[model samples]
Target: MKTQKLTLTVVMVAILVVMAYIPAIPLGPVPLTIQNIGVMLAGAILGWRNGLLAIIIWLLMAALGLPVLTGGSGGIAPFFGATAGYIWAYPVAALFIGLSLQALTRFNRVNFVTILLTIIVFGVILIDLSGAVGLHITTNMPLPKALIFQLTFIPGDIVKSIVATILTLTLRQRFTALSHA
Candidate 1:
Protein backbone atom coordinates (compact mmCIF):
# COMPACT_ATOMS: atom_id res chain seq x y z
CA MET A 1 0.00 0.00 0.00
CA LYS A 2 2.82 2.39 0.84
CA THR A 3 4.52 1.70 -2.45
CA GLN A 4 1.29 2.17 -4.33
CA LYS A 5 0.57 5.39 -2.53
CA LEU A 6 4.02 6.71 -3.27
CA THR A 7 3.67 5.78 -6.93
CA LEU A 8 0.28 7.45 -7.17
CA THR A 9 1.60 10.56 -5.49
CA VAL A 10 4.54 10.78 -7.84
CA VAL A 11 2.36 10.39 -10.90
CA MET A 12 -0.07 13.02 -9.67
CA VAL A 13 2.71 15.45 -8.89
CA ALA A 14 4.27 14.87 -12.28
CA ILE A 15 0.99 15.58 -14.00
CA LEU A 16 0.66 18.75 -11.96
CA VAL A 17 4.15 19.88 -12.90
CA VAL A 18 3.24 19.46 -16.53
CA MET A 19 0.04 21.34 -15.95
CA ALA A 20 2.08 24.09 -14.34
CA TYR A 21 4.14 24.42 -17.50
CA ILE A 22 1.27 24.66 -19.89
CA PRO A 23 0.37 28.25 -20.78
CA ALA A 24 -3.04 28.00 -22.33
CA ILE A 25 -4.53 30.91 -20.40
CA PRO A 26 -2.05 33.67 -19.96
CA LEU A 27 -3.19 36.44 -17.63
CA GLY A 28 -0.53 39.09 -17.43
CA PRO A 29 1.97 38.06 -14.75
CA VAL A 30 0.12 35.00 -13.56
CA PRO A 31 -1.31 32.33 -15.79
CA LEU A 32 -4.39 30.35 -14.85
CA THR A 33 -3.32 26.97 -13.57
CA ILE A 34 -4.43 23.73 -11.97
CA GLN A 35 -1.12 23.67 -10.14
CA ASN A 36 -2.51 25.07 -6.91
CA ILE A 37 -5.07 22.29 -6.85
CA GLY A 38 -2.18 19.88 -6.91
CA VAL A 39 -0.42 21.83 -4.21
CA MET A 40 -3.49 21.85 -2.03
CA LEU A 41 -4.24 18.23 -2.75
CA ALA A 42 -0.71 17.30 -1.86
CA GLY A 43 -1.11 18.85 1.54
CA ALA A 44 -4.68 17.77 2.17
CA ILE A 45 -4.24 14.22 1.00
CA LEU A 46 -0.64 13.30 1.62
CA GLY A 47 -0.09 15.25 4.79
CA TRP A 48 3.19 17.03 5.58
CA ARG A 49 5.99 14.66 4.78
CA ASN A 50 4.60 12.96 1.71
CA GLY A 51 3.01 16.17 0.46
CA LEU A 52 6.27 18.06 0.67
CA LEU A 53 8.10 15.21 -0.94
CA ALA A 54 5.74 15.31 -3.92
CA ILE A 55 6.39 19.03 -4.42
CA ILE A 56 10.11 18.48 -4.10
CA ILE A 57 9.97 15.75 -6.63
CA TRP A 58 8.11 17.95 -9.06
CA LEU A 59 10.55 20.81 -8.45
CA LEU A 60 13.50 18.51 -8.91
CA MET A 61 12.08 17.39 -12.22
CA ALA A 62 11.67 20.98 -13.26
CA ALA A 63 15.18 21.76 -12.12
CA LEU A 64 16.38 18.86 -14.20
CA GLY A 65 15.35 20.62 -17.40
CA LEU A 66 11.75 19.52 -17.51
CA PRO A 67 9.44 22.25 -18.76
CA VAL A 68 7.33 21.90 -15.66
CA LEU A 69 6.67 25.55 -15.00
CA THR A 70 4.44 28.25 -16.40
CA GLY A 71 4.80 28.79 -20.14
CA GLY A 72 6.81 25.61 -20.26
CA SER A 73 9.81 27.37 -18.77
CA GLY A 74 12.02 25.33 -16.49
CA GLY A 75 15.65 25.11 -15.57
CA ILE A 76 18.06 26.11 -12.86
CA ALA A 77 17.74 29.65 -14.11
CA PRO A 78 14.00 29.83 -13.35
CA PHE A 79 14.70 28.36 -9.97
CA PHE A 80 16.63 31.57 -9.25
CA GLY A 81 14.53 33.81 -11.41
CA ALA A 82 11.63 36.11 -10.60
CA THR A 83 9.14 33.40 -9.72
CA ALA A 84 11.62 31.38 -7.74
CA GLY A 85 10.32 32.37 -4.38
CA TYR A 86 6.76 31.36 -5.20
CA ILE A 87 7.91 28.10 -6.63
CA TRP A 88 10.01 27.43 -3.56
CA ALA A 89 7.22 28.40 -1.20
CA TYR A 90 4.92 25.72 -2.58
CA PRO A 91 6.19 22.92 -0.38
CA VAL A 92 6.13 24.99 2.76
CA ALA A 93 2.65 26.20 1.92
CA ALA A 94 1.49 22.66 1.41
CA LEU A 95 3.12 21.64 4.67
CA PHE A 96 1.30 24.34 6.57
CA ILE A 97 -2.03 23.59 4.94
CA GLY A 98 -1.75 19.89 5.62
CA LEU A 99 -0.43 20.21 9.15
CA SER A 100 -3.08 22.75 9.99
CA LEU A 101 -5.74 20.29 8.88
CA GLN A 102 -4.13 17.67 11.06
CA ALA A 103 -4.20 20.06 13.98
CA LEU A 104 -7.83 20.80 13.27
CA THR A 105 -8.59 17.10 13.42
CA ARG A 106 -7.01 16.91 16.86
CA PHE A 107 -9.65 19.27 18.24
CA ASN A 108 -12.32 16.69 17.30
CA ARG A 109 -15.23 19.08 17.65
CA VAL A 110 -14.16 22.02 15.50
CA ASN A 111 -16.14 23.32 12.57
CA PHE A 112 -15.01 21.75 9.32
CA VAL A 113 -16.13 24.74 7.31
CA THR A 114 -14.08 27.13 9.41
CA ILE A 115 -11.00 25.00 9.20
CA LEU A 116 -11.19 24.74 5.41
CA LEU A 117 -11.91 28.43 5.07
CA THR A 118 -8.97 29.35 7.23
CA ILE A 119 -6.66 27.10 5.27
CA ILE A 120 -7.70 28.62 1.98
CA VAL A 121 -7.46 32.22 3.18
CA PHE A 122 -4.25 31.80 5.11
CA GLY A 123 -2.54 29.66 2.52
CA VAL A 124 -3.43 31.89 -0.41
CA ILE A 125 -2.75 35.27 1.20
CA LEU A 126 0.19 34.61 3.47
CA ILE A 127 2.07 32.15 1.35
CA ASP A 128 1.55 34.08 -1.85
CA LEU A 129 2.55 37.29 -0.10
CA SER A 130 5.89 35.77 0.74
CA GLY A 131 6.33 34.95 -2.92
CA ALA A 132 5.48 38.51 -3.88
CA VAL A 133 8.04 39.82 -1.44
CA GLY A 134 10.60 37.57 -3.02
CA LEU A 135 9.60 38.86 -6.43
CA HIS A 136 10.11 42.40 -5.19
CA ILE A 137 13.57 41.66 -3.87
CA THR A 138 14.71 39.36 -6.62
CA THR A 139 13.36 41.32 -9.55
CA ASN A 140 14.08 44.67 -7.94
CA MET A 141 10.58 45.87 -8.60
CA PRO A 142 9.16 48.61 -6.46
CA LEU A 143 6.79 47.66 -3.70
CA PRO A 144 3.83 49.03 -5.62
CA LYS A 145 4.57 47.06 -8.76
CA ALA A 146 5.19 43.96 -6.73
CA LEU A 147 1.90 44.43 -4.98
CA ILE A 148 0.13 44.80 -8.29
CA PHE A 149 1.64 41.63 -9.59
CA GLN A 150 0.68 39.89 -6.39
CA LEU A 151 -2.84 41.18 -6.70
CA THR A 152 -3.06 39.84 -10.21
CA PHE A 153 -2.51 36.45 -8.72
CA ILE A 154 -5.05 36.91 -5.95
CA PRO A 155 -8.20 36.30 -7.94
CA GLY A 156 -6.96 33.15 -9.56
CA ASP A 157 -5.41 32.00 -6.31
CA ILE A 158 -8.65 32.49 -4.41
CA VAL A 159 -10.45 30.37 -6.94
CA LYS A 160 -7.84 27.69 -6.63
CA SER A 161 -7.94 27.75 -2.85
CA ILE A 162 -11.68 27.41 -2.70
CA VAL A 163 -11.65 24.58 -5.15
CA ALA A 164 -8.89 22.93 -3.20
CA THR A 165 -10.81 23.28 0.04
CA ILE A 166 -13.92 21.75 -1.43
CA LEU A 167 -12.04 18.91 -3.03
CA THR A 168 -10.08 18.24 0.12
CA LEU A 169 -13.20 18.03 2.19
CA THR A 170 -14.82 15.64 -0.22
CA LEU A 171 -11.75 13.46 -0.54
CA ARG A 172 -11.20 13.35 3.19
CA GLN A 173 -14.69 12.07 3.75
CA ARG A 174 -14.05 9.26 1.29
CA PHE A 175 -10.46 8.37 2.06
CA THR A 176 -9.54 7.60 5.62
CA ALA A 177 -5.82 7.92 4.98
CA LEU A 178 -6.23 11.58 4.07
CA SER A 179 -6.76 12.24 7.76
CA HIS A 180 -3.60 10.26 8.53
CA ALA A 181 -5.16 9.11 11.79
Candidate 2:
Protein backbone atom coordinates (compact mmCIF):
# COMPACT_ATOMS: atom_id res chain seq x y z
CA MET A 1 0.00 0.00 0.00
CA LYS A 2 2.83 2.39 0.80
CA THR A 3 4.46 1.52 -2.48
CA GLN A 4 1.25 2.15 -4.31
CA LYS A 5 0.87 5.49 -2.60
CA LEU A 6 4.41 6.41 -3.42
CA THR A 7 3.90 5.46 -7.03
CA LEU A 8 0.75 7.49 -7.22
CA THR A 9 2.52 10.46 -5.70
CA VAL A 10 5.35 10.12 -8.20
CA VAL A 11 2.96 9.97 -11.10
CA MET A 12 1.01 12.98 -9.89
CA VAL A 13 4.14 15.06 -9.43
CA ALA A 14 5.43 14.01 -12.83
CA ILE A 15 2.20 15.18 -14.41
CA LEU A 16 2.58 18.49 -12.60
CA VAL A 17 6.15 18.81 -13.84
CA VAL A 18 4.90 18.36 -17.37
CA MET A 19 2.15 20.85 -16.74
CA ALA A 20 4.85 23.30 -15.65
CA TYR A 21 6.26 23.19 -19.14
CA ILE A 22 3.03 24.03 -20.88
CA PRO A 23 3.28 27.68 -21.97
CA ALA A 24 0.44 30.06 -21.44
CA ILE A 25 -0.28 33.48 -22.96
CA PRO A 26 2.93 35.40 -22.51
CA LEU A 27 1.86 38.84 -21.52
CA GLY A 28 5.19 40.63 -21.33
CA PRO A 29 7.67 39.51 -18.70
CA VAL A 30 5.18 37.61 -16.57
CA PRO A 31 3.88 34.72 -18.62
CA LEU A 32 0.71 33.11 -17.33
CA THR A 33 1.37 29.40 -16.91
CA ILE A 34 -0.38 26.44 -15.32
CA GLN A 35 2.64 25.90 -13.08
CA ASN A 36 1.05 27.78 -10.19
CA ILE A 37 -1.96 25.49 -10.39
CA GLY A 38 0.37 22.54 -10.26
CA VAL A 39 2.04 23.96 -7.18
CA MET A 40 -1.26 24.53 -5.44
CA LEU A 41 -2.50 21.06 -6.34
CA ALA A 42 0.64 19.52 -4.99
CA GLY A 43 0.05 21.15 -1.63
CA ALA A 44 -3.72 20.77 -1.53
CA ILE A 45 -3.84 17.09 -2.49
CA LEU A 46 -0.57 15.75 -1.12
CA GLY A 47 -0.32 17.80 2.04
CA TRP A 48 2.93 19.49 3.14
CA ARG A 49 5.80 17.02 3.05
CA ASN A 50 4.90 15.07 -0.03
CA GLY A 51 3.76 18.20 -1.78
CA LEU A 52 7.11 19.80 -1.05
CA LEU A 53 8.82 16.67 -2.26
CA ALA A 54 6.95 16.90 -5.52
CA ILE A 55 8.16 20.47 -5.96
CA ILE A 56 11.66 19.36 -5.04
CA ILE A 57 11.60 16.64 -7.66
CA TRP A 58 10.40 19.07 -10.29
CA LEU A 59 12.99 21.67 -9.33
CA LEU A 60 15.76 19.11 -9.42
CA MET A 61 14.64 18.09 -12.88
CA ALA A 62 14.67 21.70 -13.98
CA ALA A 63 18.06 22.19 -12.40
CA LEU A 64 19.31 19.18 -14.31
CA GLY A 65 18.53 20.94 -17.61
CA LEU A 66 14.92 19.94 -18.09
CA PRO A 67 12.89 22.72 -19.69
CA VAL A 68 10.19 22.45 -17.07
CA LEU A 69 9.80 26.15 -16.56
CA THR A 70 7.46 28.43 -18.42
CA GLY A 71 8.11 29.45 -22.03
CA GLY A 72 10.74 26.77 -22.41
CA SER A 73 12.97 28.55 -19.95
CA GLY A 74 15.33 26.00 -18.52
CA GLY A 75 18.90 25.05 -17.84
CA ILE A 76 21.27 26.56 -15.30
CA ALA A 77 20.96 29.96 -16.84
CA PRO A 78 17.47 30.50 -15.53
CA PHE A 79 18.49 29.44 -12.07
CA PHE A 80 20.91 32.34 -11.97
CA GLY A 81 18.92 34.63 -14.19
CA ALA A 82 16.24 37.23 -13.55
CA THR A 83 13.61 34.72 -12.50
CA ALA A 84 15.93 32.86 -10.20
CA GLY A 85 14.62 34.19 -6.94
CA TYR A 86 11.03 33.39 -7.83
CA ILE A 87 12.07 29.91 -8.90
CA TRP A 88 13.90 29.41 -5.66
CA ALA A 89 10.88 30.60 -3.72
CA TYR A 90 8.61 27.97 -5.30
CA PRO A 91 9.37 25.16 -2.89
CA VAL A 92 8.95 27.54 0.01
CA ALA A 93 5.68 28.67 -1.44
CA ALA A 94 4.44 25.12 -1.77
CA LEU A 95 5.48 24.23 1.74
CA PHE A 96 3.75 27.19 3.29
CA ILE A 97 0.67 26.71 1.17
CA GLY A 98 0.43 23.13 2.33
CA LEU A 99 0.95 24.06 5.95
CA SER A 100 -1.63 26.79 5.88
CA LEU A 101 -4.28 24.28 4.89
CA GLN A 102 -3.26 21.27 6.93
CA ALA A 103 -2.50 23.25 10.07
CA LEU A 104 -6.14 24.07 10.45
CA THR A 105 -7.59 21.89 13.21
CA ARG A 106 -11.18 22.29 12.15
CA PHE A 107 -10.65 19.95 9.19
CA ASN A 108 -14.22 20.03 7.93
CA ARG A 109 -15.08 20.07 4.24
CA VAL A 110 -15.89 23.74 4.05
CA ASN A 111 -13.01 24.66 6.33
CA PHE A 112 -10.64 22.63 4.20
CA VAL A 113 -11.75 24.46 1.11
CA THR A 114 -11.50 27.80 2.86
CA ILE A 115 -8.06 27.05 4.20
CA LEU A 116 -6.93 25.86 0.81
CA LEU A 117 -8.14 28.99 -0.91
CA THR A 118 -6.55 31.24 1.69
CA ILE A 119 -3.23 29.49 1.52
CA ILE A 120 -3.20 29.26 -2.25
CA VAL A 121 -3.77 32.98 -2.61
CA PHE A 122 -1.22 33.73 0.04
CA GLY A 123 1.35 31.56 -1.65
CA VAL A 124 0.68 33.14 -5.02
CA ILE A 125 1.06 36.61 -3.61
CA LEU A 126 4.31 35.65 -1.97
CA ILE A 127 5.62 34.28 -5.26
CA ASP A 128 4.57 37.41 -7.10
CA LEU A 129 6.24 39.62 -4.53
CA SER A 130 9.41 37.58 -4.59
CA GLY A 131 9.39 37.54 -8.37
CA ALA A 132 8.97 41.28 -8.45
CA VAL A 133 12.02 41.72 -6.27
CA GLY A 134 13.92 39.29 -8.46
CA LEU A 135 12.98 41.30 -11.52
CA HIS A 136 14.08 44.51 -9.90
CA ILE A 137 17.43 43.04 -8.95
CA THR A 138 17.95 41.29 -12.28
CA THR A 139 16.80 44.08 -14.57
CA ASN A 140 17.86 46.97 -12.36
CA MET A 141 14.39 48.45 -12.75
CA PRO A 142 12.58 50.76 -10.38
CA LEU A 143 10.44 49.18 -7.69
CA PRO A 144 7.22 50.68 -9.01
CA LYS A 145 7.65 49.19 -12.46
CA ALA A 146 8.59 45.86 -11.01
CA LEU A 147 5.41 45.87 -8.95
CA ILE A 148 3.37 46.73 -12.02
CA PHE A 149 4.89 43.83 -13.91
CA GLN A 150 4.07 41.49 -11.07
CA LEU A 151 0.45 42.61 -11.05
CA THR A 152 0.06 41.23 -14.54
CA PHE A 153 -0.28 37.79 -13.08
CA ILE A 154 -3.15 38.71 -10.76
CA PRO A 155 -5.93 37.50 -13.06
CA GLY A 156 -4.26 34.27 -14.02
CA ASP A 157 -3.22 33.50 -10.48
CA ILE A 158 -6.76 33.97 -9.23
CA VAL A 159 -8.03 31.61 -11.89
CA LYS A 160 -5.37 29.06 -11.11
CA SER A 161 -6.11 29.18 -7.38
CA ILE A 162 -9.82 28.66 -7.93
CA VAL A 163 -9.35 25.77 -10.32
CA ALA A 164 -6.76 24.05 -8.17
CA THR A 165 -8.85 24.43 -5.02
CA ILE A 166 -11.88 22.92 -6.73
CA LEU A 167 -9.95 20.03 -8.22
CA THR A 168 -8.15 19.31 -4.96
CA LEU A 169 -11.36 19.32 -2.91
CA THR A 170 -13.04 16.97 -5.38
CA LEU A 171 -10.05 14.65 -5.43
CA ARG A 172 -9.83 14.68 -1.67
CA GLN A 173 -13.45 13.59 -1.35
CA ARG A 174 -13.17 10.95 -4.02
CA PHE A 175 -9.84 9.52 -2.86
CA THR A 176 -9.65 9.16 0.87
CA ALA A 177 -5.99 8.30 0.91
CA LEU A 178 -5.10 11.51 -0.83
CA SER A 179 -6.37 13.45 2.15
CA HIS A 180 -4.36 11.40 4.62
CA ALA A 181 -1.01 13.00 3.79
Candidate 3:
Protein backbone atom coordinates (compact mmCIF):
# COMPACT_ATOMS: atom_id res chain seq x y z
CA MET A 1 0.00 0.00 0.00
CA LYS A 2 2.80 2.39 0.86
CA THR A 3 4.57 1.52 -2.34
CA GLN A 4 1.40 2.11 -4.31
CA LYS A 5 0.96 5.50 -2.70
CA LEU A 6 4.53 6.52 -3.47
CA THR A 7 4.22 5.33 -7.03
CA LEU A 8 0.99 7.23 -7.60
CA THR A 9 2.44 10.36 -6.02
CA VAL A 10 5.40 10.24 -8.38
CA VAL A 11 3.10 9.65 -11.31
CA MET A 12 0.98 12.66 -10.41
CA VAL A 13 4.10 14.83 -10.10
CA ALA A 14 5.21 13.64 -13.50
CA ILE A 15 1.84 14.48 -14.97
CA LEU A 16 2.04 17.99 -13.56
CA VAL A 17 5.54 18.43 -14.98
CA VAL A 18 4.43 17.30 -18.41
CA MET A 19 1.32 19.43 -18.35
CA ALA A 20 3.40 22.44 -17.36
CA TYR A 21 5.42 22.11 -20.55
CA ILE A 22 2.34 22.41 -22.76
CA PRO A 23 2.02 25.82 -24.41
CA ALA A 24 -0.12 28.15 -22.37
CA ILE A 25 -2.75 30.47 -23.77
CA PRO A 26 -1.31 33.86 -22.93
CA LEU A 27 -3.94 35.91 -21.17
CA GLY A 28 -2.69 38.79 -19.13
CA PRO A 29 -0.55 37.65 -16.23
CA VAL A 30 -2.07 34.27 -15.69
CA PRO A 31 -1.62 32.17 -18.78
CA LEU A 32 -3.96 29.23 -19.08
CA THR A 33 -2.24 25.90 -18.73
CA ILE A 34 -3.53 22.36 -18.52
CA GLN A 35 -1.68 21.87 -15.23
CA ASN A 36 -4.90 22.29 -13.28
CA ILE A 37 -6.27 19.23 -14.98
CA GLY A 38 -3.41 17.26 -13.50
CA VAL A 39 -4.05 18.83 -10.10
CA MET A 40 -7.74 17.88 -10.21
CA LEU A 41 -6.93 14.36 -11.29
CA ALA A 42 -4.31 14.03 -8.58
CA GLY A 43 -6.94 14.68 -5.92
CA ALA A 44 -9.60 12.55 -7.55
CA ILE A 45 -7.28 9.63 -8.11
CA LEU A 46 -4.76 9.84 -5.27
CA GLY A 47 -6.97 11.21 -2.52
CA TRP A 48 -6.37 14.50 -0.69
CA ARG A 49 -3.22 13.75 1.27
CA ASN A 50 -1.31 12.09 -1.49
CA GLY A 51 -2.51 14.56 -4.05
CA LEU A 52 -1.30 17.44 -1.91
CA LEU A 53 2.03 15.75 -1.47
CA ALA A 54 2.44 15.32 -5.17
CA ILE A 55 1.70 18.97 -5.80
CA ILE A 56 4.10 20.01 -3.06
CA ILE A 57 6.82 17.93 -4.63
CA TRP A 58 6.25 19.51 -7.98
CA LEU A 59 6.16 23.01 -6.52
CA LEU A 60 9.36 22.42 -4.61
CA MET A 61 11.09 21.33 -7.77
CA ALA A 62 9.86 24.40 -9.58
CA ALA A 63 10.99 26.61 -6.70
CA LEU A 64 14.41 25.06 -7.00
CA GLY A 65 14.64 26.51 -10.54
CA LEU A 66 13.29 23.64 -12.55
CA PRO A 67 11.16 24.55 -15.58
CA VAL A 68 7.97 23.15 -14.15
CA LEU A 69 5.56 26.00 -14.69
CA THR A 70 3.74 27.26 -17.76
CA GLY A 71 5.95 28.31 -20.69
CA GLY A 72 8.90 26.61 -18.99
CA SER A 73 9.20 29.32 -16.41
CA GLY A 74 10.47 28.37 -12.97
CA GLY A 75 12.20 29.50 -9.74
CA ILE A 76 10.76 30.93 -6.56
CA ALA A 77 10.08 34.25 -8.25
CA PRO A 78 6.91 33.08 -9.99
CA PHE A 79 5.40 32.17 -6.67
CA PHE A 80 5.53 35.85 -5.78
CA GLY A 81 4.20 37.10 -9.09
CA ALA A 82 0.74 38.10 -10.27
CA THR A 83 -0.25 34.50 -11.12
CA ALA A 84 1.23 33.19 -7.91
CA GLY A 85 -2.15 32.88 -6.38
CA TYR A 86 -3.32 30.41 -8.97
CA ILE A 87 -0.09 28.49 -8.77
CA TRP A 88 -0.30 28.16 -5.00
CA ALA A 89 -3.95 27.18 -5.15
CA TYR A 90 -3.34 24.00 -7.08
CA PRO A 91 -2.71 21.72 -4.11
CA VAL A 92 -5.52 23.17 -2.04
CA ALA A 93 -7.89 22.67 -4.93
CA ALA A 94 -6.71 19.12 -5.35
CA LEU A 95 -7.16 18.39 -1.67
CA PHE A 96 -10.66 19.84 -1.67
CA ILE A 97 -11.69 17.79 -4.67
CA GLY A 98 -10.20 14.65 -3.21
CA LEU A 99 -11.78 15.10 0.19
CA SER A 100 -15.17 15.90 -1.33
CA LEU A 101 -15.08 12.82 -3.50
CA GLN A 102 -13.99 10.62 -0.62
CA ALA A 103 -16.81 11.84 1.55
CA LEU A 104 -19.31 11.35 -1.25
CA THR A 105 -17.97 7.89 -1.90
CA ARG A 106 -18.66 6.99 1.71
CA PHE A 107 -22.36 7.68 1.20
CA ASN A 108 -22.48 5.45 -1.86
CA ARG A 109 -25.70 7.23 -2.74
CA VAL A 110 -24.21 9.46 -5.41
CA ASN A 111 -23.76 8.27 -8.95
CA PHE A 112 -20.45 8.66 -10.75
CA VAL A 113 -21.68 11.72 -12.61
CA THR A 114 -22.82 13.33 -9.41
CA ILE A 115 -19.51 12.63 -7.77
CA LEU A 116 -17.62 14.07 -10.70
CA LEU A 117 -19.74 17.20 -10.77
CA THR A 118 -19.32 17.75 -7.07
CA ILE A 119 -15.56 17.46 -7.28
CA ILE A 120 -15.34 19.75 -10.27
CA VAL A 121 -17.60 22.40 -8.75
CA PHE A 122 -15.72 22.46 -5.48
CA GLY A 123 -12.37 22.32 -7.20
CA VAL A 124 -13.22 25.26 -9.45
CA ILE A 125 -14.54 27.36 -6.62
CA LEU A 126 -11.60 26.72 -4.35
CA ILE A 127 -9.04 27.22 -7.07
CA ASP A 128 -10.60 30.44 -8.31
CA LEU A 129 -11.05 31.90 -4.86
CA SER A 130 -7.49 31.17 -3.82
CA GLY A 131 -6.15 32.43 -7.09
CA ALA A 132 -8.10 35.65 -6.81
CA VAL A 133 -6.96 36.21 -3.26
CA GLY A 134 -3.38 35.54 -4.20
CA LEU A 135 -3.51 37.89 -7.13
CA HIS A 136 -5.00 40.65 -5.04
CA ILE A 137 -2.40 40.27 -2.31
CA THR A 138 0.61 40.06 -4.55
CA THR A 139 -0.36 42.70 -7.08
CA ASN A 140 -2.22 45.00 -4.72
CA MET A 141 -5.11 44.66 -7.11
CA PRO A 142 -8.62 45.13 -5.84
CA LEU A 143 -10.35 41.89 -4.93
CA PRO A 144 -13.31 42.62 -7.18
CA LYS A 145 -11.10 43.30 -10.14
CA ALA A 146 -9.04 40.23 -9.46
CA LEU A 147 -12.15 38.11 -9.24
CA ILE A 148 -13.57 39.63 -12.37
CA PHE A 149 -10.39 38.93 -14.23
CA GLN A 150 -10.56 35.37 -12.91
CA LEU A 151 -13.85 34.99 -14.72
CA THR A 152 -11.94 34.85 -17.96
CA PHE A 153 -10.54 31.45 -16.99
CA ILE A 154 -13.86 29.93 -15.97
CA PRO A 155 -14.75 28.50 -19.36
CA GLY A 156 -11.37 26.93 -19.76
CA ASP A 157 -11.44 25.63 -16.19
CA ILE A 158 -14.87 24.09 -16.79
CA VAL A 159 -13.54 22.32 -19.83
CA LYS A 160 -10.52 21.10 -17.88
CA SER A 161 -12.76 19.98 -15.03
CA ILE A 162 -14.86 17.95 -17.43
CA VAL A 163 -11.79 16.32 -18.89
CA ALA A 164 -10.41 15.62 -15.43
CA THR A 165 -13.76 14.20 -14.37
CA ILE A 166 -13.98 11.82 -17.30
CA LEU A 167 -10.40 10.72 -16.99
CA THR A 168 -10.64 10.26 -13.22
CA LEU A 169 -13.84 8.26 -13.47
CA THR A 170 -12.46 6.06 -16.20
CA LEU A 171 -9.26 5.46 -14.33
CA ARG A 172 -11.07 4.87 -11.06
CA GLN A 173 -13.20 2.17 -12.63
CA ARG A 174 -10.17 0.47 -14.06
CA PHE A 175 -7.99 0.80 -10.98
CA THR A 176 -10.21 0.18 -8.02
CA ALA A 177 -7.29 -0.10 -5.64
CA LEU A 178 -5.92 3.30 -6.49
CA SER A 179 -9.38 4.89 -6.40
CA HIS A 180 -10.06 3.48 -2.96
CA ALA A 181 -6.66 4.54 -1.73
Candidate 3 lDDT, 142-178, residue by residue in tens: 9999999889988888888788888887877878865
Quote model 1's TM-score. Answer: 0.84
Off by over 4 Å in 3: 177-181
RMSD (CA, Å), each prediction: 3.0, 2.9, 2.4
1-181 in candidate 1: lDDT tens per residue? 4885698688768767777755546655445566767877787767777888888888898899888876777789866776666777888877887787778778863255755675565567766777677778777877677777777777777777777777777766767665465
Question: Residue 27's C-alpha lDDT in candidate 1?
Answer: 55
| TM-scores for all predictions | 0.84, 0.86, 0.91
Off by over 4 Å in 1: 21-24, 27-32, 109-112, 177-181
Instruction: Give RMSD (Å) of candidate 1 vs. truth.
Output: 3.0
TM-score of 3: 0.91
Query: Which candidate number would show the highest TM-score if scored against the true structure?
Result: 3
lDDT (Cα atoms) of all candidates against the true structure: 0.72, 0.74, 0.83
RMSD of 2: 2.9
The digit string of per-residue lDDT tens for model 2 on 1-181 reads 3675577569767877678667678666556677877777777777778878888888888888887777655678777777766787778887887777776634553454585566556558888888888878877878799889887888878878888777877776777665575
True-structure lDDT of candidate 1: 0.72
The C-alpha local distance difference test score for the whole of candidate 2 amounts to: 0.74
